[model samples]
Target chain A: MGQVLAPGVTAPDFTLHVTPDQTLSLSDLRGRPAILAFYPADWSPVCGDQMAVYNQVLPEFREHDAEVVGISVDSAWCHQAFAETRHLHFPLLADFEPKGAIARQYGAYRDGEGVCERALFVVDRDGIIFWSYRSPIAVNPGADGILDALDRLEKQENSDGRAQSAGNGG
Target chain B: MAELKVPVTAADHARGGANGQVVLVEYGDYECPYCRLAHVQVMQLGRHFGDDLTYVFRHFPLTEIHPFAEPAAEAAEFAGAQGRFWDMHDAIYAHQEQLSLLFLMGAARALGLSERTLEVALEAHTYAPKVAQDFRGGIRSGVNGTPTFFINGHRHDGPFDYQHLADAIQSVRSGL
Candidate 1:
C-alpha cells in the first residue's frame, strides 16, 4: 500500500479524459466540494459495486453540493464501456495514458499492481482536502466517510459564511 | 481493516459452529448474484470448520440496485421470529433468479411459514428498522457492497472465492 495524501494538503490537480474527447481537471470543480474516488479497476467486482453504491447515493452527495468523480488507471474506452454497463451517471477519469500518474500524485498508485489503491478524498469548496481514506485493496471503502466528511465541510462552510456576513455587516 | 462493529449475539442467525474457535460474519443481500455464490461457499466452509467455525449472516441490502433486498431481509427476520430464519434465508437464495415480492411471499409459504405474519410485518415495515440498523452497521464497518466478510472480527480483505476464504480462515484460526 502506498502512503496516501492526507487531509489539510492541497489536492494535486490533473485534467484527465472523461471520455475520448472531453477532459476534467480538479480545478474544474473548484467552487463546489468534490468526492474523488480512486479505485483499482473498471468493472472489477469490488470497484464496480463501489462505484454503483456511489451512483446510488449521488442524491445525498448532491444535498451537500458535492460532485463525485471516479479515477482509475483503465483506458477511456474501457471506462466508457464500464460506465455504460453500470449505468454510471458520474464521470470516470482515465489515469491511462501515463498509467496511474494522477493516482501516484495522490499517493494512491500501487507500484506492485500497476493500479490505484482503493482510496477516497473529500476536497472542500476551496480545493483543500477535508478528509481522505485509503482502504485495503480488497475492501470497498463505502460512502459513509465521504458523506461524514462532506457534512463537516458543510457545517464549517455554514459557520464561516455566517462569520463573513457578520463581519461585512459591521 | 474494519472490524465487525456489532458482535454476534442470540439475535443473529448462526449455524454449525458451536463453541467455535473462529467467528465468520457475512453482511449479505438476497438479491445479489455474488451472495448466492457466497451462500454455497459458506455452506462448504461451515462443513469444513464444523465446530471450529461459527457463521453469522447479517442484512446489508443494496436497496437501490436490488429493490427486493430489504423486503427479503425483513421476511427472513420475520421467519427468524419463528426460528425458521435459516430456512427462509436458504429458500430465498435457492432461486436467486426468482427474487421479488411475489417470490418472497411464495418462498415463505413453500417453507410452511405464515404469509399473514410476513404480510403484516412487511406492510408495517416492522423489520425495516432492523434491516436499516444492519445496513448502518455495515457502513460503519466499511461494507460498501454485499457479501463482505469479517473473519474473527477483522474484515477479510481478500478475494471471496472458496479456496481463498478457506485459506484466510485457516490463517486466522491458527493465529488464534
Candidate 2:
C-alpha cells in the first residue's frame, strides 16, 4: 500500500484523460470540492464494487457540490470500457503514460504493483486536501468515509462563514 | 467494529424469532440487487432461527442510481400506516426485478392498500423524512451500502450470506 496523505496538504495537480479525446485537470474542479478516488484497477472485484457504490451515491456527493473522480493506472481506452460496463456517471481518470505518476504524488501508488492503493482524498475548493484514507487492497472501501469527509468539509465551511459574519458584525 | 448509534425503538419495523436472542439490523435499499438477495436470506434466517432472532430493516435508498427506491420506500411506509409493512416489503422484494411506481401501486392494491392513497403519499413523499432519518442513522452507524448489517448493535463486517450470518447470529445469540 502507498502513503495516505494527511489533511491540509496542497493536493498535487495533474491532467488525466477521461476518455480517448477528453481530459480533465485538477484545475477543472477548482470551484468545488473534489473527491479523488485512487484505486488499483477498473475491473478488479473490489474496485468495481467500490466504484459502483460511488456511482450509486454520486447525487449525495453533488448535494454538497463535491465531484467524484476515479483514478487508476489503466489506459483511457481501458477506462472507457470499464466505465461503460459499470454505467458510471463520474469520470475515471487514467494515470497512464507515466503510469501511477499522479498516484505517486499523492502517495497512493503501490510499489512494483503498477496500480494504485485503494486511496481517497477530499480536496477543498482551494485545492487543500481536506481528508484522506487508504483502505485495504481487497476490501471495497465504500463511500461512507468520503461522504463523512465531505460532510465535515461542509460543516467547517459553514462555521467559518458564521465566524466571518460575526467578525463583520453582521 | 462500529456500534449502532441509534437503538431500536417503536419507530422501527421489527420482526422477531422465538427468544429474541439476537438483533440483526439491515440498512437496505429496495432497488439494490444485493439487498433483494439478502431479503431472501434474511427470511431464510427467520425460518432457521425462529425465536432466537429479531430482524430489523431500515431504508438507505441510493436515490441517484435507484430512483424508484425512495418511492418504493414511501409505498412501504404507506402500507405500514395500515399495519401491513412486512407484507408490502416482502411483496416489493418478491418482485424486485420489476420495481417502479406502477409496480408499487399494483403491489399496494394487492395488499389491500388504497392505490390512490398510496399515489398521494408517494407524490407528497409523506414518509421521506422517516426514511431519511433511517438513512442518517445508517450513515452515523458506518453503513456504506445496501444490506449493511448490525448484529446486536455492532457492525457486522463479515459476509451476510446464510452460513456466515447464521454463525454470527448464533454467536450473538449465545452471548445473550
Candidate 3:
C-alpha cells in the first residue's frame, strides 16, 4: 500500500467533477498555493460545521492567495446538495464512482470503512505538499489550523526559502 | 442542490445485503480506538438481533494522525473481495495495532488468503474505490464522525450499545 504523501512530496494532479461546475482541476490553481481539505462525508455535524468555518474564513484564504478546495467521495449531485446546504464558496469535488481514489492517493482514505478521513494538505504552486494534518474522526479541524499553515507558507514564500527549516506545518 | 435518492447500483445491492426491519448504518474510522470499541458493540447488536438486523459499515479514517488506518481499510477490502468481509472486519478491530502492512498480510494469511494473492490484491488496490464509495455514501447522509449509527434510516441518538441498538431495532421492527 502506498504510504501517505508527506511534506515536500509532489501532490498527484487530479481533475474531479465538482459541484457548481465539473471543469475544475488542481492544475487550474497553478501559480498559487492551494488548500485541499478532504473530509469523510457531507452533511455530518462536524464536517458541516468545519465547512462553515472555512466559508467564514474565506477572506483569510483569499488574502493568502490560496484557493481552497474541498474533496469527498460524494457524487457530483451530492456535492451540489452539500455545497448548497452549507453555502460553501469553494469547489467540492465528487470522487464518486471509485470512492476514495483521490483520498487514497493522498494517503487519507481509511481502509476499514470506505470513506476519506478528515485530512488536510497544503500544496504550493508547484504542487508540493508543504504542510499536512489529519484530525481524528471525532475531532473537527478548524480554519485556524489551515490559516496558520498558510501563514507559515507565506513566510517561506516571502523569504524564498526552503520549507524544511521554515516550519511549514503548524 | 437537493439530495436525490440515486438508484442502488448492483455493487451497492450486493454489499448492502438482505435488509431486515432495522438497518444499522455505521460511519467509522479504522484508526479510532473509540470506533474500534463501537465495532464490538455493533457486532454484539448483530448477534443479539440476528435476522431482524443488518449493519452497513462506512469509512471515515483520519489520515494525518493514524498512518496505518488507510492500509488497514485496504486489507479489509481484500478480504471483502473473497466474501469474508465480516471476518476481515472483526480481525481488523481485534488487531488494530497489528494492522500495519506486515501484520495485515499476516491476518490475511490467518484468514486463509495466500500471501502472494494478498500482496497482489492489496497492491492492485482492488477494493480501494469501493471503500471510498462507502465514505461518499456516508457523506451524502451527512455523517462527519466515526461510529455514527443510524437505524432504519433514522439517526440513533445515543452511544449505540446492545441495549440502545436493541431498543431501536425493536421499535423499528415492531412498527413494521
Please name the candidate that would achieve the greatest TM-score relative to the true structure.
2
User: Second chain TM-score per prediction?
Assistant: 0.97, 0.97, 0.83
Worst 10 residues of 2 chain B by lDDT: B138-147
B1-176 per-residue lDDT for model 3 (tens digits): 11212223335412223655567777677777878888887767767777667667766554444567777787777787788777877888988866678987888888898778878877887777877776545544544345666676655655566687778778888898
- Clashing residue pairs in all predictions, respectively, total 0, 5, 14
Report the number of backbone clashes for model 1.
0
- Model 2, docking class: acceptable
> Rank by TM-score, descending?
2, 1, 3
lDDT for B133 (candidate 1): 80
- lDDT of each structure? 0.87, 0.86, 0.73
Weakest ten-residue segment in model 3 chain B by summed lDDT: B1-10
**Top lDDT prediction, candidate number:** 1
Residue-by-residue lDDT tens digits, candidate 2, A98-146: 9888998999989877789989999998899999988777655777688
Q: Which ten residues in a row have the lowest lDDT in candidate 1 chain A?
A: A161-170
Model 2, runs deviating above 4 Å: A43-49, A56-65, A78-87, A111-113, A154-170, B1-3, B17-19
Docking class of 1: acceptable
- Give the clashing pairs for model 1: none
